[model samples]
Target chain A: MTFVIQLMSGLAVGCIYGLVAIGFSMIYRAMGLVNFAQADIMMIGAFLGYAILVAAPGIPFWLAIIGAMLGAALLGFVIERVAIRPSVARRADQVYLVLLTLGIGIVLSNGARLIWGADPVVYPTGLTHQTLTLAGYPLPAVYLYIAVVMPALLVGLHLFFTRTWLGLALRAAADDPDTAATMGVRPALATSVSFALASAIGAAAGVLYAPISYVSFDMGVIGVKAFAAAVVGTLGSIPGAVLGGFIIGLGETFGGQLIATEYQDSIAFAIMIGILLLKPTGLLSGARR
Target chain B: MESKSPAALALTGIEAGYVAGVPVLSGVDLEVREGEVVTLLGRNGAGKSTAIRVICGLLKPNAGRVELHGERIDGLEPAAIVGRGIAVVPEGRRVFGSLSVEENLLMGGFAHRRGIAPKLDLDAIYTSFPRLVERRTQLAGTLSGGEQQMVAMGRALMAKPRVLLLDEPSMGLAPMLIDAVFDMISTLAGKGLTILLVEQNASEALDVADRAYVLERGRIRREGPAERLLSDPEIRASYLGVG
Candidate 1:
């Protein structure tokens, strides 16, 4: 029973990492950009959820999550339009684009610090502490929520990408922008939509995560673990991201028993390096260079 | 040659290149009349592909004007150019490797997709290329080279384009496949689709085209009827490798 409980908690944490990693993979696949600001977008989403809850104290938790996702998506759209697009239009060097993303990440983290203050804020929901018994075993209610919500999100994303024309356009533009253009797809529009979709996914992770842990401006540091998860799973594959998240989360939980707690963060990177050394393209990757 | 139909597509004195000062296509003029099949023939670096790029709005000419039935289109974005009924089957049969064949066809119809009327029919496309019907769900990248070329052509045709620009449609294909492609081109022209074909295979290109232009060093060195050029001693020696 205790092992099962530990596994459930590990899976819950893995879900959070997977959500953020999806954003990383989406943006990376679309534009070959490793957006450092993606995790910080999660931070901003948490703050947005908090602000929304404060504004309407009686609002449902789902509504708050939606509001936060929409807010972060708008911010992502603005960032792509105001900053990323111009640099790309001018044909900036690849190194410059990478640095630009790093700089934007710094600005976002520090900007959140200024706006939300340095103190950690707790979610005002009673659901955080709520518990339920499943087959005579006690389980955190938030874990149940995470389990339901993650699968729901995965289904929604799958439908959006496969069953919709906009999704087809996004994939087409990402694969071959020049050919897509000849086929009458506007590359700029496809790119903007990709950024918005990735940001919203990140924001969903933030809202889901806030009930369990205190939301801080620097909470985005967890992004590195998610990045490792993305790389480990396969940088651009969505399923790979989710699988990577589980590996990291479960590894950390089990390794905590054998190793010092101080080395917990190092485990994810260690796994990432090990995977890369064995298979540089990643476990699920189709050998993309 | 004078025709009752105005120039369906025309490029006047187009000058363009990858580098700022060095031009690959310099002071080059070409035209395709309505329902005409015009072939541009040249050696490896004679700028045949560059001319196609200029006409399709892929590369903005440093100084030139591209026209569709007299209206300018050079400075427009490639999507806008396609929206105005010009579609190009780019070199190398660049099918979206990850997307399914049906998805690729759907993307081609994206411009006029908003209206209730289905301007482009998937069933029609599938019927035209019977081989594609069975492979509709397969990723384009996994297909053989000839199948990818069919997908590229069907994708371009999905736009219901009035003018079709084909860039080396026979490139890297088996001789049997090349004949099949030329037969398809002849059929498209029979249905009154204006075409601009760029080719290195001079004999087959001249066989399928009504008119031919020879480009050398970014200049139009020869212009005449396709059959006349086919029998010319100079063209026979330089391009056809015949005495």
Candidate 2:
């Protein structure tokens, strides 16, 4: 039962990592820039949801999640236009974008600390309080939510990429920006949309995560773990990132139980390094260089 | 080439290159009439590719105008130029390697907003390149050099372009594949597609083009019907090495 419980918690945590990893994958593929601020963006989303829940006490949790997603998406658009796009236009190197995103992350984390204080705050449990009993096993309702939501988002994203014009444009830009531009798809617009979508996904993960972990400034570390998962899965493959996240989550959970809990973070990093060393292209099949 | 309509694409006094103050193509002038296949012939660094780039809106001309059906397009973006019905099969067959062959075709149809609509049909492309149909599910990067070129051409055709610009379509292909590519270009031109073909393979280019321009150091040194240019003593001696 304890093992099952640990698996459940790990899976939930893994789903959050998967969501953020997918966001990173999308932006990286579209513009060839890793938005290092992705995790802090999630932290900001959590703080926003917490503030709204406090201010309008009767607002439903689902509504708060939606609002946070929209807010984060809007913030993503503004940041891309003002910060990222200009740097790209000026032909800055990838390292410059990395430094810029790191600065953004620092600003967001410190800003959250200023607004909400450094103390961890209790977020409403939503459905997480509910528990499920299976064949001699117990699972948190949040774990079930995570499992369902992650796969559902993956399916939706698949449909978006395959069935929609906007998604096709995004995929085309990701493939070859120059050729895509020649085919009447604006690379800049596609990249902006990618950033917005990534931010929304990050925000959704934050909302889902807050109920389980309790919102805190330190949650940004989870973003680093998610980045590790993305690297493990192959930086650009969406499905790969999700699978990598689950693997890391499972490893961390079991490692915590069987080994030292303090090493949970280290376990995720070790898996990432192992994957890189073994198959540099990642576990999923795709182009890496 | 007897259509009374304006040329499908025209460039006058176009100047462009990669670096400032050191032009690769200077004062280059060319035109392709509706349904005409015009070949741009030059040795390496003779401005064949530069002229194509300027016309395709990939690079802005340092001086002069590029017009498609009488509308100036010199300052337009590549996407906008595509919207104006020009598609380029760029040099080196830069296919989207990660995408399936079918997806690459679909991307080609991205520019054709509306028309007879069959202009950008996948069936048409597949019909033209049947080999691509059999390998539609495969990633483009995995294909052989010749097959990748076919995919690149099929992708451009998916745009249902009024003017198709092919840059070195025969590059890196085997002798048999080169013959096949030239045959396809001739067939496309026969079907009334206006084409601007840039090639270092002067003989094959002349065989397919209705008219030909010989460029040297970014300037047109000779221009005439393909047959006339092919038989010209100077062209045969200098470009064809047949004298």
What is the Cα-based TM-score of model 1?
0.96
Clashing pairs in 1: none
Off by over 4 Å in 2: A55-60, A125-128, A136-138, A285-289, B1-5, B113-120
lDDT of 1 by residue, B1-243 (tens): 666556999889889998999999999999999989999999999998888888777899999889998899999998899989998888898999989888887777877788632334788888789999999999988899999999999888888899999999999999999998999999999999999999999999999999999999899999989999999999999999998
lDDT tens digits, residues A1-289, model 1? 5777777777888899999999999988889888888889998999999999888987888888899999999999999999899999999988898888778888988998898899998777776688888777787777777887899999998888887878888898999998888877788888889999999989989988888777889889899999998999999889899998998888776676468757878877888899899989888987421
The list of candidate 1 runs beyond 4 A from truth reads A287-289, B1-5, B116-120
List iRMS (one decimal) for every candidate.
2.9, 2.7
Residue B163, candidate 2: Cα error in Å is: 0.8
Residue A43 lDDT (model 1)? 89
Q: Identify the leading candidate in terms of DockQ.
A: 1
lDDT against the true structure, per candidate, is: 0.88, 0.87
Residue B187, candidate 1: alpha-carbon lDDT: 90
